[model samples]
Target: MYCDESGFTGNDLLDQGSTYFAYASVAINHEEATEYVNNIIQKYKLQGGELKGRNLLKSTKGKKVIAEILSTFKDRIKVGVYHKKFNLACKFYEYIFEPPLSEKSSLFYQIKFHRFISNILYLDFVCRSEEAEKIFSDFQNLMRKKPNYLFSSSETPDMSPLDDIKTFCIHHRDTINQELNSLQGTDIGKWILELSTSALFSILCDWGKEFNQLKVFCDVSKPLKENKELFDVWIGIKDKIYFDFFQGVEEPITFNLSQEVQFVESDKFPGIQIADVAAAACAYAFKEGVNQNTESWIEHIPGMVIGKSVIPDESYTDPNTLDATRNLILLRYLAEKSINKQPLLDGIEEFLSAVTHDLNLNPSNRIATIAENSRSDAPYFNF
Candidate 1:
């Protein structure tokens, strides 16, 4: 299958003009994807270079082409969406990293995104500066790697790598700004990431059930380096993603990276183009706030969507605000068990306790045991 996203702003996720971020992916029925792409190119007289979604969604003819494409491939597409606000995310991080960084606010309360995000929060929000040199250190000396078979039973308490934070928050209660309540925070890129990977793994999970390997393709967002390839920009989901079903009693469903997944220019493959169309269409649907004709293109792209910000349910979501805990979990994007396909809401603790999942010479997945001294005013994050 192929996957791609619309409305990517890198760290510019909180820009208000970009209200929503979406990821869309299509299954790899190669012959059918090719046939559809050819029909669209011939029908629209599209020049051979590429058929990008943003361009295709701009014209009346393009709209017709999109509508027809939707009509043709509705079942093969999947989408996930998130609405974000950067300001709110900043505030939440501040509140977490604010003064009184002890007790519950210790290393136990947060998932550092496999050590990628803790410094961002600790330095940026909490106003602590010790190392401009070891800025790349893995935040925790985690005990294990990604948890695929850890949860053998639902009856097992959700003792994930992320459990420490949940437990700390539940017990300490006042470590963060509890009143700054919102379901999702403004860290839009992370939210986009959360949405994108979830979209991919949902397919991986279902395919895992069938014991079938699925290859993933995504549109190229970065300039291709001559010899090196960017790996797993999305954490938790590495070159491979796996999850155990049936309470971990069954063999885990596993998927790998690079060889199993390919990142390509949109022009070379028909599937990526369609995924582009589908991703943009999803962005439009969320903005329109209605699923009628203007938004009908989404009807053609079928897949589960998480973090739907359109619902008026303030009980959990408010497009205009930020909720402390949710945003924290979101920024890390590594607290859930992709291996067991377990709910990621608790995956951070597992991530905190995990180690050595990487199989290569370059240890990009840096992990460790870390417990910052919350109250020692000396600014201690001694690894």
Candidate 2:
């Protein structure tokens, strides 16, 4: 597969106006991609170079070419989309509340906890833009250090990022917010916040499992190039079981990946150019909303897209609806492994019960459930 990304704002995700990030992997060989590019160039009487996706989306002819390419090779393409704001919230919750960074796991993580936390943060960031901006700014600063950052400090910890989060939670003491108070004066270490590397690996894992082996070609990406060794370790992870310390739940994931990727220039590889177009177009469709120009592209995306945005539109979700709540639980479960089904269901029920109580307290407030409220009827493909 050939890969490329679009709308990458690096770690500066909040202010860049690049609300969505997309990484696309196209399953077309070099010869086919080359032929298609040559044909398009000859047919359109256009300049021959790297057929940039961003440029292609500009004009009627370019858009037509993109539409044709998408329609022609819809099944062979796989795109991963990330809602930047939601993604940032998820990162914050994961680092502060889950796994190696945080000492213990929270029961909330199992039952749409990430979403719950993200919704709260998302709202705070949206409603209180200045304060929200500072939170992200502090977070970006905190993540630039070497040596493991400590979360449980005996001495006074740097409170820039941690305090920002705590202040937000303390100001509004809800269930999720109060839970965030655990990291009041702690720190989360440096983690590469870019989406491309992880997204590419996920696509590789899925494709690798299907093909048993893959000869991958990625357009020269700094993250992919720098984290080559990390990718190797991730694919061949021996300890597949990641235990949730809070619930004593062991989530085991087995990967069938066994290959190294080759990072090449898009100018030399037509396949990578095709991936570029697909990724850029996909990101644009989501970020700009599906209009007449983007509707055709959306039609080709449903099954091919492997998206991470649990909540596409924050407000469209109806938290009071049991079905919506159930779907979120289901999506979370399906995305990760659950060895014990009954307890998981019980957990979901407990969360729902708590939601009911919370709703009764403030009937005017709408809870954010997972909803597909994009301009087009494009389905979200999780996992």
Candidate 3:
């Protein structure tokens, strides 16, 4: 099953807006899925590690260890790392409230670092597509094997009656929040949320079907309401695609979310693929800026761009461009840190100029001139 989330983090107080959204997805077949849950019990040997029991990580140290082990295998883990970097950068500027290098009270001089490491990691993974294919092949093989094969005879019965293929798209908000509430620091919460988002994205890519045939089932929660803007953007995009794809058909495969989890016996709702949609959501979040109805931007941005370079294409919007743009704004806030501010300003000007050229913006000269004029405090200009 795939799992993902949006708006886990509260708004950015410094910017008076949220700077990050996170999502995670995971995928597993029936046998592997059963084994995964069962292994949690067997590995930890918990008193009540039965399938229906709530085996939270806090209950036991062994359980925590087991949870971490399982988390490493999740698809969204890398994406989680990226989100963590962004969150850390935000905290460094806001919560840490570190004084500016040169100025004691000038908050405007504080660095606003834009964390795009997650995108770089994603691009690296996709560039190494062969590895993904190999891992997926191994997963399928493992799924087909008998459940008992991985366990001793004493533990074999625990995995029996695992024939039914069930997929659940669980948002980790409640669990993470519960864990964080007991903790003393904000860093762990940031990391946990990042991990959850990455895992959700991974699940989506593995279990999700083609965009033409996809449905999402979710539990009603506050985060959903908080992130309604993002959802709306994505749904709007999906609707346009659906209309285009089924122009001649009387009815087309529609994408919608339902709170109801019930499905008829014959009904085969494809397993949840949270990472696929989470990646799409992240793409949209970056494109539309952090706001409600950000999901509408998802339709305009192609899913083909997932795990690809940040350079924009007619088919795929470059999330890197958006990230870079955000970073430029942040850099302006950091400009006062430089001993030679002119050189720093020049670098920023050159980078923005290149981007404008690449975007084919008409009146690029006018924009560059404005950027040039924005550089007023050049030390050499004193002569």
Candidate 4:
């Protein structure tokens, strides 16, 4: 499979109206992708650069490029998306850094330790400067259907800025770090980012077991070496980090999650380039209130979509594959994962519980929120 990501930054996770983070994988071979690329180049009549969804989604011709590329790999694509909750970043930050640099707080969260710092971050990130304010204002305007969108809300629409934010953070973590140093070292930001980026592939890992081996190609992102390390750790840590959350699991689920991971410039690899286009299309579909691919986006990923398990021990067996379905019960699947890993979850379940419960994405009603008296010993801090 050729895999590529659209948005993933160390900081933009808190913005609900961002790309959040999205990864797309296609089962098509490089040769096939290459054939499609050639057809697109000829059809579009000359393109010096490789095709990308970001570039293509702009012009009418570009949209066709996205459509054509997706059509070539229809039924072979799988995508995972997230409009990360900023609170989620705090939770992850708290969880990763031992004796967190400072206490973590949310005006909307219950924690009291670092309330001051939390407020500072919010102001700096959301309202600090003119550019930031303008960006945020534009984002708010984009969310016309949802009022006072807190972003982490369970109901309503949001604007996604994950791609831009993530890309920005990757390039400017040091600069942002100087201002937000109270939250442990900037490394926490990077690790949290690793989780979001890698987490996107949980389904891919579950489904790859059906095949003998998997080779993944992705477009280059900032700090190539570090992104490579993050990707590797992400692939290996799933079972280590999430196995205990499952019910029947003893030893972690074992499989060759990936045999080879190659990061190439988008234009250099037609396969990775098309994967980019597919990812962007999924993000557009998701951000536009279309949870799953529809309209011009369904040309890809039209085949069986594997099921997602809400708990820890559950694995995607070959039988779980179903017709292409979006929304794939994302809220429950992620919330349960967060809930089950409570000790490492930064003890902030109020918002987690609210979003997870309100979404009601779980079919079995097995997801027990804190409100339901599902108890844990962690010291939660969300408002």
Cα TM-score per model: 0.48, 0.68, 0.29, 0.50
1 versus 4: better TM-score goes to: 4
Q: Tens digits of per-residue lDDT for model 4 on 1-383?
A: 77677756554444445644567777777788788787787889746757767767677777666766666566677766654433343332243221322243232223222222222223334434443344344333322222332222232211112212222223333433443345444343445433334444564565455554556666665533454554465443334322532245432243344544576776767778776777777667655643333456554543423233111111121112210011122222323443343332354455445544544465233222322221122112111
Lowest lDDT sum, 10 consecutive residues, model 1, at 136-145
Give a tens-digit lDDT track for model 2, residues 1-383. Answer: 89999998876667566778889988887898999988887887767666899898888888888988899889888888888877777776665444321322443555455555455456556655554555555555544432332222223322222233443333222333344444444321223466776787667655644464467788887767766765666444433333443346443233333466788998899999888988889888887777988876677877778633233454323455543344343334422322222322346556567765765565443333333211112122111
lDDT of 4: 0.45
- Per-model lDDT: 0.45, 0.61, 0.31, 0.45
Arrange candidates by TM-score, descending.
Answer: 2, 4, 1, 3
lDDT of 3 at 275: 33
Candidate 1 Cα errors over 4 Å, as ranges = 47-49, 86-211, 223-260, 291-295, 298-313, 317-383
Model 2 misplacement above 4 A: 99-106, 145-191, 234-258, 307-383
What digit string (tens of lDDT, one per residue) describes model 1 on residues 140-229? 100011122211123222432233323332332343324223323433322322234444544444444433445667677442111112
Model 1 whole-model lDDT (C-alpha atoms): 0.45
Q: What is the Å distance of residue 324 in model 3 from its true position?
A: 11
Worst 10 residues of 3 by lDDT: 160-169
